[model samples]
Target: MNGDNRIHLVRDEIRRVSACDHATLDAVAELLGTREINVLAGRLGMVAAHMASRAGIAEGMPPPGTFPGAGNERIDLAAQWNAVTVAGWFVRKKLTAWWWHDVLFDGVLVTYELVKAFVTAVVDDDPSHITRLTLRLRALSAGRLVIEVHDSPENAHLISAADNLISPQVEHVAHHCGRHEHQGRTVLWCELARPELSRWI
Candidate 1:
């Protein structure tokens, strides 16, 4: 790009723009290739995670206490569950709706099927729907896994204990389905009680 073709900075932009000249921009572009540019911010190109780390943050996350609930411990179910080929494939296909599991649950036949049914009911397993599910071992409960399905606001209206949605009346397993306040959102919660779950562990 020619110097004449470069964008002219306005007064406000000049203030917000990081102190860097064309040579610096050219060096950044050459060193990083396509990754380094924030044209709108008028700043030097920096990888997001690296920038966060430099700011005393971790992997694009603000430091603890930077936000209202940043201190709470939250596990990334995807890191483990998505490693399973089938689960990863499913996530990739939908792009929005995702089925997940935490370290506690082995996600066997019954558990996996039930969780899938609950999520599919709300999102119909469609890629456009933003519904997602997470399964974790219920605290202070023996052989019980809690499945929380967080629905998109637009689709939460479809959450139900309908027979077609969740086979709650089944003979094999007795489960509880209800809504609970989780982080200010009404989460579709289900408890899967399987005493034999400990066998896998």
Candidate 2:
């Protein structure tokens, strides 16, 4: 990606983060004036790396290796999600003035935060959640970024009630949506488009 593409991705991410953070669209508009896309993108990327490192340390996992090189980028989706997840937590508890009300009404943000907190707490307890966490990121982008995470049956009987719990919101994500179960793993995935941006792939 060129500088322009980077800027576009960063700006879109910032807008999305702003949304997930419960910043009113108006508040994001306010930010547009003072923040340059490149600077914000750099900060976003750094924030993600920092949070991912913290999550890894909390889990007692070894830190990831440095990037092979900048051009070798393959979309560190886990870290991206980590960044957004941590941001969601911060936005809800630290940044927003209406945290209490928004937590109830902002379903997308709520679910995202739930997944983050759940994943963080589980990773803190055991290492197994790392695999599921990686899988969740892949499933998120496999076809179109449509993805879901629920508790395993052993941990929580989530699969049986997934549809009733999430269908109303996720129905539009894919025509063929369902759960996939493995020995100790379960995931609900769908196809979702990356939100269109003016630049980059």
Identify the candidate with maximal lDDT.
2
Q: What lDDT does candidate 1 reach at residue 14? A: 46
C-alpha lDDT score of every prediction, in listed order: 0.37, 0.40
- Tens digits of per-residue lDDT, candidate 1, 82-178, equal 3234443332332222223331233333334444555555545354645444433222122233443343454445544323443443224434444
Choose the strongest candidate by TM-score: 1
The C-alpha local distance difference test score for the whole of candidate 1 amounts to: 0.37
The sequence of per-residue lDDT tens digits that candidate 2 reaches over residues 101-172 is 322224244345435543554454544533233323221211122234545444343333333333444445
Point out the worst 10-residue segment of candidate 2 by lDDT. Answer: 67-76
